[model samples]
Target chain A: MTRIDYTDLVGGLGLVLTGAAVSYVSISQYPLGTLQRMGPGMFPAILGVLLAGLGVLLSLQALRRPGSRPDIRIFSPLFVLGGIAAFALVIVPFGLVPAILAITVISSLAELRVQPVSLALLTLALCLMAPLVFVVGLGLPISLVRWPF
Target chain B: MEFLANIGLGFSVALSLTNIFYCFLGAFLGTLVGVIPGLGVLAAISMLFPLTFHLEPTTALIMLAGIWYGTTYGGSTASILLNLPGTPANAVTCLDGYPMARQGRGGVALFMTTVASFFGASFGIVLLTLFTPVIADYALRFGSAEYFALMLMGLVAASTISEGSAVKGLSMVVLGIIIGLVGMDSQSATVRFSFGVMGLLEGVSLIALAMGVFGVAEIIMSVRRVRTADIDPETLRLKAIKPSRDEMRRSWFPMLRGASIGSFFGTLPGTGPSIAAFLSYAIEKRVSRTPERFGNGAIEGIMGPESANNAADQTAFIPTLSLGVPGSATMALMLGVLMIHGVAPGPNLISSQPELFWGLIMSFWVGNLILLLLNIPLIGVWVRMLTIPYHILYPAVLMFICIGAYTSGFTVLNVWMVLVFGALGYAMRIFGFPGAPLLLGFVLGPLMEEHFRRAMVLSRGEFLTFFERPISAVIMALTGMILIWSVWSAEIIRRRRAARAAGDGATTHEAREG
Candidate 1:
């Protein structure tokens, strides 16, 4: 027989860990009063246990019948995530225009190889459009350009 | 009659110049987003959530409603042309729409679907007009126990009906509830899970959760499939839009049947347009004499599902407007908009805010009419819109999402939340868990908790109070039945799949022996 699906196993593990973390926080941090007078943490603690139980059930089911796994590429997520991080870093200090340009050019790299001309054109278009639509039209208070230094 | 008077009031409000302008703008923008694959109406609405923050509630709602239905009209464009669905609602359209396009009947298919959509929407609007008052009146008597039961039913139905592993869907729902709990505990005045972050005190922004999971995660998934060259949209001749008489004759009843099915499912919480569309398609397949034509560019294939989805979109507002229980994620977003404008939606909303209710209903008719007019002649523009490559389109979507997230609370913290949820959402997708339930869970979680707490308090913490109340008992019984039905159905599906696999294996073995 084919090997058991590692993806479901991993998913089951992740869910269990998340449930455990929530349960831990709920138990340690908050007050869980008796059944008659439920405290703030009572509901969350119940939900955490439910989640962990479900995860365990899923793991057991996975052993009986393996499921299909998805193809996970490494670089695309990196570039996409990196682009958002770049925007977050720049939006305050560097300003809207640079942030837009950074996010646009950086995210386009998720396609692996970017056509420089198209990338530049997209950057220019976004730089104009973002300011016009967001700042000028909608009147969000952000300067067009700023130098962090 | 009272109905006529209400209609008159609605028309007076909806026909105002300002409302018209907003409606037109929403339809135009909604079509643009819907035509572009990967930008579903939920993401688009969340991305534009900031834009409406400044408008009057009525105008904001009118525009939002326009966008919701407009997307329904425009979602079919991509399915017809590229076999790609702009939203889950339109996914069924690709079965025959692309085939029809390949056979050079693309224009005709588009025209028929548009007409079918209008028919279905009109039917739904009529139902909405008649039923909203009745449902609202009935729901007025519901106590906390009933409301809790209803919300629980909605969550369970959503988890089971969503197309994936039920366990994973339920887990996601629980996860969403946990996420919803990540703010100040309103009852006790103690901070629950903010982890000392100031942003968590106010709660995780809905726009961030939506834009991240639906918008940003979609971009992440689409990265691998990005084609450098855009599709040629001009090849489909726009002039060939007229349907043949035979096709027209076959479609009318199917449209009506589809509308009825759509309306039924749309009123039920947790069931949305996608389910309505698929169910309508299945019904059409079963009822048709020549069922063999269904997958091979059949006119019924395009007409039934398209109409059903559009009808479903309209009737989905029934639960949201009257009961104040959003039927889907998009409807939940609209509920958020209502709350943002300080208009609490519930049984009392229709009575307290008749102008808002009637005006919104009237605006739906106007919007659908506008969508019909817009879709017919503007097919060329939408088709041409397909030529824009994903690389360009996604960056623009990402930028809007970032801006929208930031604007949700005017804090950068929400933008950070977007990144975190986007990664989490992508992981969910990789593991084949349905995101819709997660969204529904997030939207309804806080409300569910509040109702549950209130019920518990009233009963002095006796859990039996849930079953003691008549309405709550009936609702809970229904929820239980639905859960059992879904579990049974899932088992049947698995057994059938296994049997098919075994059959194939046996056939291969016999072939080798022979």
Candidate 2:
């Protein structure tokens, strides 16, 4: 017998878990008053229950479909997310230049075929332009150069 | 006479040198980003949102509105030259616009789209002038119940009409609402889902969310499929831009039809430019005598969808301005900006802020004119932009997204949030969830909750008050009808597929028996 698809089942499970987490947080962390004169938790708790119900519905729908293998990849998401994370981590302590350089170099690494010359050029261009646009034109408070050392 | 006086007041403000320069700047930047394949108008606007923080509210709105419509004009450039849609709304343009380019008519296609876009913008401006006052006046009668019903209808429309599974879209909307409900509650002053972070008190920043979903996600998507486009120089010849008399004749009615259709859908919340463009293309195909000529560079193919997209881009402002309900993510961003500036967008906005409304209206015309001037004679510049490699472009775009997120609240937490949502956005793209509905839900969540709470309070805990009010009841009924219709349609489609499969099985069995 052909196996029913679990791709959407996984999605449904994710939704249910998220919903459950939200509901738990709302119910326990905040006060859920009566329906008419509601507290902060009332709306979120309602939404959370509704989400869980929809997640179950989605899982049921997924069961009727023919299963297809999932495609998995790791590098692009990792490097791309790492790029932003690196920028976020560095921008405060080390400031904008290193952060901008780090993001440019790291994000470019996500490409299947990375060209070193172009990456350097991109880094150089962003290093020059980021300050011009964010700092000079907009006069944002962030400094261009601040080294912890 | 009142209309004329109002317009005169608008012109007086819009014609100021400062406003005109900013209007031109907006148009220029809009076209610049619109010419890039993965850099959408939303990304561009969010990246530049901080620039407008210093300008007066009216001027800021004028510039932002310029960017919105200017994108429609510039979106077709990539479609014509590289067969890549510069924006998602321009996807329909590629059906014929690319073929026209392959046929050495790229110059003419670009020129015709510019004219069509101008016609569409003019039509939408006329509609905006005619309808805004009427709608605002009508909206003035709205109580809490009616407002609640309307917002619910909008939210329902956004989720159901969006691409992918209705259930999935609904789930995304709910998720968005949950995200929106985070931070401190206005009434109870209770922190709902901040996880005890001090920065979450102001709520998730809209700029961060936009940059994450649109900008950073785009960079990630483009990185995997990055290729440089080669533009044919012959297509940019000045003489090649002029269409023959027959081509012009064929295009005239399609532009008008497209603009009319666009204005209708654009005024309806949740049905935005992409849907309008697709609908116009479908209508054009159905109406055309030579439907067979559509994919082979039919003039109507480019003219209809191009006009419709631009028209929709302009008229989408109607709900945002008059009703305080955003029609699209871009409109939501604009609405957000208005709120940030202490200007409320609602029925009272027209009476209270005549300068802002009229000046913004007038500036759209000036912006369209600037776009025409920018896109037509300066076509060579935008075409050249198509040649920049994805490797170089994505990094620059990523940098801007980072800065945009950081500046939104000037907090490191916002940048971190951008990273988190960016990864989620990429995942959603892979899984076939529509981002626009989620965005619309996020933007409107607080307003919907506010209206819901107010309506309940007014009714003294009676849920029937929503239906007791005539306008609210009618609106809610409309929402229910749409939900039912989608469900019915999904069932029919499922049944048809099953029957087709069964028929195929029977055919195979008969062949084996024979």
State each model's TM-score restricted to chain B: 0.95, 0.96
Model 1, position B403, has a per-residue lDDT of 75
Return the lDDT, model 2, position B394: 80
lDDT of 1 at B60: 94
Q: Could you give candidate 1's per-residue lDDT for residues B1-514 as a string of tens digits?
A: 9889999999999999999999998988888888888778988888887889888899999998888888888889888888888778999999999899888888898899999999999999999999999999999999989998988888888788767777888898898888888889888988988988987997888888888888888889987585533444544556688889999999988898999999999888768899999999999999999999988999998888988998888899998998888878788889988987999988999899999999999998888888889999888888888888787788888888887777666678888898998898899888777777788788778888888888988998899998999999999999999889877888898778766766786543223334
- What level of docking quality does candidate 1 show? medium
Q: Write the per-residue lDDT of candidate 1 for residues A1-149, one digit (tens) a residue.
A: 33455677778888899899899899899998766667888888988998998889778766655456578977777888788888888888878988898889888889887889988898899899989998889897887789879
Assess every candidate by TM-score: 0.96, 0.96
Candidate 1 C-alpha error for residue A72, in Å? 0.8
Give the DockQ of candidate 2.
0.65
